[model samples]
Target: MQKLTNTIFLLFFVAIGQGQALPNLDSLLKLVPAAKEDSGKVLLYINIGQQYESNHPEIAKQYYREAGALSRKINYPAGIIKYINNYTFVLNMQGQFDSSLLLNKQAVEIARETKDSINLGKALFNTGTSYRVRSDFESAIRYYEEGKKVFERHGSEETQAIANDILQLLYYSLEQFDKAIEYGTAAVTYLRKVQNLPFLATAASNLGISYARKHEYEKAKALFNETYNIGLKIHDLNAQGSSMLNLGDIALQQSRYSELEKYFSKAEKIFLELDAKESLVISYRGLAIYYLFQRNYPVAAKYGEQGLAITNELNLAFEKRKTLETLSSIYIAMQDIEKGEEYLRMSTRVGDSLLSETIQKNTIEIEKKFEAEKKETQIKALTANQKVQQLSIERKNFLNKILLAAGAAVVIISLLAYRNYKQKQKIQEQRIAELETEKKLAATEAVLKGEEQERTRLAKDLHDGLGGMLSGIKYSFSTMKGNLIMTPENARAFERSMDMLDSSIAEMRRVAHNMMPEALVKFGLDTALKDFCNDINQSGALKVTYQSIGLENLSIDQTTAITIYRISQELLNNIMKHAAAKTAIVQLSHSEDTISLTVEDDGKGFDISILNGARGIGWTNIQTRVEYLKGKTDIQSAPQKGTSIHIELKTS
Candidate 1:
């Protein structure tokens, strides 16, 4: 989980020649000679650099160096910053963290001198990412936050989102899941708003892993599925394979053996097809876990060995460490005590080495931070002394006038003090009101979380405990039916009892599903709502006509989507019980910035004015949820007519 998995993000920013085929070196060289302007040559060089970035970092580095030299010769600050950042990107990818950080800092200084906010943000982000790769989370967060503020001020939504996404990953690694979820959710919304498909997919993947770490498996699986589908659409095989491995991990955790096998196998095949050895390491690890779970020691060992071999060949110390741990467990389970001890020792040695490396990086980061703070403090002290000297000079000049203005100043000061007191009073009142509102919102959130947790616990209890017992009872009844010979009347009684038992089992499943629908967990809001409407329609109690636009393709945050679903469910329940509606229409509209829900019924209605006076818990719950979401809601009703409820929520 400490691994950043930021290759997709790097590719998104560096793959400038992604859509078009890369020109040959000969053609690029010909164009370079034909370019009359140094800027044009620099652009060509950068383009060539991007073409070589993924496959040939050394070549890309040289191209970027050439571009930087040309930009410096032309005195193009923006161009200099650009090429330097590009060069730093290649160094960053090559694990040259110290060199990358130095170059990025140089780019930042140049951008600051030129007042290039965009490039400054880019440089800060790259520097932060390098720190993140080195396990210097505090430094990474500091730079990322600074970059985020710069992008926000410049209205660079895509870059701002990328910064936030990286921050989320950092928070996740730091085990601050709540903060991670907050930023992760924000990043996804911002990226989707900008329609940045590749970054959005990566954000979703990172968010899913965060949720998985927090044991939110259902939400995690949904996000992994989303990333997988997005990767398919974008033709990103690495993203696809990574998401497949995540899905397999979720299935493995849930004990869904068949699904686990399917996902792992698919992931392995994709990695093999693409020859993605790094990703293949993860696939092999998943396969090892799968086989270990099945108690197939031999196959687990094989997969574990494969993972180790690849990690060792590629010099992936982290992956090698993980593979060693897995092999240790496998050998221990196989009762090969001597081999197990050897693997355990090897794992310990690798773990210690990684820990020491992290400690060294952290020490360097702390020293850097200390030096920066020291410089800032020294500058501040100098500024303060200068200010004091200036004040002394001003005092000398104003001494003659001070006596004359003192009386007038006293009166003015009195008035100003009164005004300030009044302002403070008003501010205090406003703050009090805000605090009250926040307290209520906090209480509401707590209640909602508690309800969901209870629902999860109850669903699990019903499904695994009571449901299993009932299934056992049913099986016992079948055996009894096969073994017992009875009169027709006795047999009829026995059959009726069996029928009742079956009904109970079905009822239990229905209750559990209602508590926490698997459809909602697995398929998301769109499918869950449609299935809900279908169930109502099939019952012939109230005819439900459901319609949706743009929801199928939408990637809504799971928590938000579930809140909308619950609101819809409550609305339909109200229509069924209170409105006496025979038919209802539920419409969902999804857009870039807003999600709107409409529920209309064709039954006898009441005055909308009475809604506020209504003593129904259902309306209270709906209002609380809508307020919690910071959404707008409207209810319209008339006697002998129909009722309509409309809700609109801002997506971000």
Candidate 2:
């Protein structure tokens, strides 16, 4: 898992335009156990392709490419499907999203043929990670989480753990520290149990970063130290180096410059020894900051230049932005305000792009009740573009027409054109404003309609299926209890029957409560989710912790609450059935216009593909419910990784 991310980040270091080459075909082809005929070769390729998903994705792709060709040659249905996922992962890594998407579809077909959740989740995870790398965090998270469902069902701990790590990072990027920590903590726990030390350290470092960002310095320090120690124990020099680097960052933030410098030096030593210049950027920046604090201008400038050069070579925008900030600080300190401001503007531009990308990635969601590509968004975007074009054209055209006319004609044409120009500008502004309003309205209507539909469906289901069954069970138990005689043996049997009757009654109550969750409407969303989580917590299957922010009665309408409630319930059901999780979190957050809810659990996850075909009907139902609500849900998990379900609703 760690290797996959490292490869992704490191590729920027290797070359910018040139693509990656993977020997997956050879590796997987060898896994076939030397079956001379088509079956042995195809099976070998498929097995190897699965293995390459994490450690050597490029290699995995080649295996799949070859496997697909070989399978088609011999008409091996399963082999063709296996290679399809590998091919998708390869394309995804190379940033060919559209191709990756098409390949995912092909992989899905093959998974259905083989009835394999493992391969199915792989396809979904690949697609998801591609989006994540593209900075479509929300969509990426959605795909990864959906894949988790498949992993949990298919029983792939490695993939599940990997998915959780991705989620932990995604939430962190979103500045949702609590969710980030929750998922990060769960990820570490799983990887450690499975002896995945390298990834474990990565997860710990991430958790530390989350805690640090949240300003829980103590927790962050502990997690970082833990990660550092694990890295040492595992002989993972890279992880150890990164851990120390993060430690330096935390220390610097806490204003412990001494410790910060020490940690950075230690990490720098490792990176320098290994010639990992890209990894050295953080340490260089840290040293630059230290020197700047001490008023050592030349030293500070030197270190800053080094950091900038490395980042530039790597083409890491985020890193480059940081370097620019340091450069701006240096220029300001040197009494060069103009230079400082130039760097400042550059940093600002980069920061905006980075933030925008992160927001689009982490905030937008799939499994939504409404169209993710909403009409309002479309109109506003189109209007904004058209306005720019119109302004440019009008500026030139009006002048041309006025110049071509003579005397009175010129006067009349100029007046009319001027009027037309003003009117067009006015109309464009109005359209923009209206489009903004329409976007909000579209979001609101989607939530309202989706919730109403779910409530109606759940109501009908309770009235018909579970409700009737519970009633029949109660009647049968009641009749049996009434028939018991009063002898000692009869008394014991009667007591047992009563206990059974009581249990049934309790179960029925739970069912009824879940179907409607009256608290959602009466007490509001926060209290209702808490109550629901408490019920689940008592089951001992998992511990559910819930949090809410600005989630008072202001933003939650009946339809919104109900829709969120149903979606939450479906997520819980998925966890119970799939995620071998010991603990979970349900959080609700609201801004003035949006409502976000997340249900995260430390459980065994499954691939998303398997959820529809290989796993069961639960996820499909959950997905349908989310779609009906016109809100959005992001389901993330991998084998043994855990599951994170994110729901974002526009309520205002």
Candidate 3:
């Protein structure tokens, strides 16, 4: 995983050359002779630098420096930002984190002053990369998140996707697989849509690593294969090698020894040919695992030692830990007990150090978030106090004017003046009451919006995060069943547990769907309602018929749609639980300036008088939502009869 970081960084540079065809070195040089000293020439130098960036970074730096100097002479901020962006990339590749950070900071300042949002986003992302390389995960994530917002606002979809890819890799490094998959999925989707093979290959390969970590071997394999094919199409050896290495890792995990040797050997050959030392470390580790699985202790130890040496030289703590563990295993298998124990102790120490570092980084990130939130709260409080003081001063000035005017009046007209003052005070009180009402409405709206947002977030977490984890656990248990020998009683208990697990997963999905239905967000209110009714029908709880009118091409706002859906949902739930209902009807209709919803059920109903007093939470919630929409609700019900509810809201 640590080695894959370098692979992704390399692919990011390769992506710079994508989207358009670049002129050959000779063609660029030929234009240089006739080019004027302007921004165009500055761009030409940067473009030329990009050509040599991957293979000859020193030469790239020379061209980048020339561009920067020329841009400063011409007072071209964009050109200077571009120069710093390209230059620091090469600096990062050469392990010059401090220099890269300094240059990127300068670029950020210039971009900000010049209002170059696109360049600012690039600078922020580059700064994040430098921090990531220095193992400052908290700072790296902050910059990446900030850059993602800027790109979303001002850059293209492709640029935003690129930012997603970078954040995905950073989160993956922190072992946040769910977050990684979320961003990585977005990046892969866009890259594939645009047919950007070079970028797609790398993004897919990186995403596959996250899936693989979650024990989803099949999905991981498919992505790696996609990466390999894309790499072949784009002539990206690094992509090809990284994918092969990842595939080999999957094979090792699944104990597919024959495929392991083939994949690892191919990866090793590619990395060796490309002279990618960091990637080669992974290749060596994979081969060692393959050999160890084959019971060839000497060969396994040989490859493990080679990987350990490179990890030590490069100071890759994560990879070093893994290599040490592998060598320890090989020595133990060969009966070198003392040597095995020595290697085991070293591995433990390395693992402990890595764990400690991760914990410290995470702690720093948490503390930073707390402080930011605390500061924001303080600022809001201060602003509120200032508003209160201003309002108090205005009231005092108004009273003083009233007192002066009353003193100026004659005693004979005192009653008239007093009456006028009393009337004005009454009007002001009415106005204050109206303002208080408006404030309450605003607060309710905020609460509803926040509730919906939280529901959506929770739904995503359940479906993508917890759901995947549960599925993985079930898969592991199923796989273990075939490998284990158990008594009949134990087997029966295991079967029961599996059944319970399946039920739990189904219940989770149901809960998540209720929280936020995917159809509601994607297709719209009509389709989502239809799906909900269909699901109820399938469940055999009650027959629910749904219909919509004047909604074929009409679009409803999300808040209104969700409110209507929830109202209908609550009505149906009550019918299922309390109403001895056999059938129900849900109808939604929209007009030019209004929307209407009607729900009816044939069931034993309660007296309508009961609703005038206290009601259950569900009924109260329905009433609250209707009030929030400034809508009218009509309910008709009687004992031994049916119930019907109608709601109408102004679309205007």
Candidate 4:
């Protein structure tokens, strides 16, 4: 089974309450002609747009555009923000991620400039939705966390609940079931309190999925039943169909095969009537899996093929992969080994393509985030400069007024005042400089955090998704090896092929580990560093001597630990790639509030002054991270002599 299709629609219901009747579109249109070109008219346009949003989005877009133009003409920031929020939401629903993201970012800028916290929070959440739809989970989580904080502080209970709902789904996507349940429970409780049937059903369904993931089957079932009943009350076909599909999944997990056909059949019928191809795909796949378990290959194959057809038509790579796997199982059960293997290969190819796409998208998003931060920092600096100039002008005007009011007696006083003003202005300029540095550091921190999140995501995808597929393929090949009767030459060739497969698996594991070492997360920084050094030593690329002090029983935050680990990792990688190092020493120590790291390598080195001119990404990244920690870096290297680098940071 798949996630509920009603999840996206929850945003719409949250924005426009389902409890109240929608405004009459014709009445709203008639009112538009007589409405003044003011904020009230902007709101009227929005209301009319909302009336058309569900059934006629293109018409809704037109109205929203008119509202936005009017709001701009009136110089109404709130109206403009609202217009962007509503307009981009429709864009997001239409799969125009680029346009939605651009408009949402604009809304954020406008809201920030106006100091409108409520609208700012809403814009942030909407921007996160755009990233989430594009499968940029790292960026999505970052924005979601920011929006959650804003809503908690300034937004209403309903808005806070909506934020929690979005976070729950995001965590669920990350496979962080515990976090998902935490947010989901909060959202469901508030949604139920308000008796918002549409949102409640969706929230409860999501909460149920989290419970189901945690193997709390009873809780999941109860939630699913609640959602189903809510759907019946609201007469929401999408909710009903989704709930039925979820229940079928739960039944399959619990080995209650008898219930599968009933739930799946009902879901299929409802989805077909509603013309929801995505939900229908899940329904078909569920029936296929049910029949596959029943040993009825023909029936299973039929449903699986139906799902595959829809997935292909929709160009849904993820769903297509699942359907292909189901069909492969059906064919294999029917003793059609050739077709089974062919389908299996196709599934693997699709999975690989998805994995590749994910990596490419993450890379692009990281660059985009960095550039966005840079632009924001520049804007802030310019704004600060403008404020300073304005303050100077106001001060000068006041001084001129004092001079004009008095005679020569005011000349001496004016000189003294001007001297004091100059001093204060200097201080203010220094303060602005400090603020600019802080902003730059903040931007660097965001980029580093984004990079780490991307690495973790890629590591998980590689280790869990592709790793399992490769392992299964190896197992299948091994099984076939025993069943085949081959000549000695063919057997030797098979052995070589097996060896190559083993190498590939090992290489993949190595790459995954390097991306994000499990040791770094499970053990403390000291142990993770030690393990990394040991791995390098075993590889024989460099002999790394690791030393630690005052870190045995010390506790460090995850962010700090990750930063330290990456610094060491990058230093070592640079050593191997550029230093031609035979051996290196990595020393880490913590005393009181300060931590120090020293790396010395016995290899050919270049002039350290070269870093002053231009540097590679690795060197730039190291400098950025060190600056982000508010630390100091000292490097000593020249000609063929070895290089030594030391960094120190205050943990407190």
Q: Largest TM-score belongs to which candidate?
A: 4
Candidate 2 error regions (>4 Å): 1-109, 135-138, 156-163, 233-237, 269-279, 334-342, 345-440, 443-652
Residues 290-320, candidate 4: write the lDDT tens digits.
8866768799899999999998998988888
Which whole-number lDDT from 0 to 100 does residue 639 have in model 1?
90
lDDT of each: 0.75, 0.65, 0.79, 0.80
Write one digit per residue (lDDT tens) for candidate 3, span 1-652: 1333334444443212223346788899789889999999998998888777655667889999999999999999998888888888676555567998888889889989998888888888888877886767778889888888888788888887778888887987776799999999999999988887766876888888889888988998999999889878756576677788778767766768778779878888887876667678888877886786677879989999998999899898877876776677677666676897798789768867866776566556545655575566557556755765676566556656676667554443455545755675577567656655655565567567656866885686567545754664565467568878999999999999999999999999999999999899889999999999999999999999999999998888989999988988998999999999999999999988899999999999889888889668998888888989999988899997899989999988
Q: Give the per-residue lDDT of model 1 (tens digit) for 456-517.
A: 65686577545754664565457557777999999999999989989999999989988888
lDDT of 2 by residue, 1-652 (tens): 0011222232211100011233455654554665676777765665665555433556667766877898888887766665665566445534456776666667666766777777677766666655555556667778777777888887456666666766776775556778877887787888778776656666777777777766787887787788778757755466567777777776765667666568878888877865566567777878887776676868888888898888778776877776777777776666576887787788778767865764454334422423554554667667776886677577657667766665677577667767876787788778767766655556655444544545544454454433443443444445445665678897888679768867776776676577676687568878888898888888877788889888665655666566677677777877777676778888888887787888888877768665556445556555655554556767687878877778777754
RMSD of each: 15.6, 26.1, 11.2, 8.7
The CA lDDT at 167 in model 2 is 72
Can you give the lDDT of residue 195 in candidate 1? 70
For model 2, where is the 10-residue window of minimal lDDT? 11-20
Ranking by TM-score: 4, 3, 1, 2
The reply for model 3, stretches above 4 Å from the true place, is: 1-19, 29-35, 90-99, 128-146, 170-182, 355-652
Sum up the clashes in candidate 3.
0
Output the lDDT of residue 497, model 2: 73
Please report the candidate that would top lDDT against the real structure: 4
What is the Cα-based lDDT of residue 357 in candidate 3?
Answer: 73
How many Å off is the CA of 646 in candidate 3?
A: 47
lDDT of model 3 at residue 247? 80
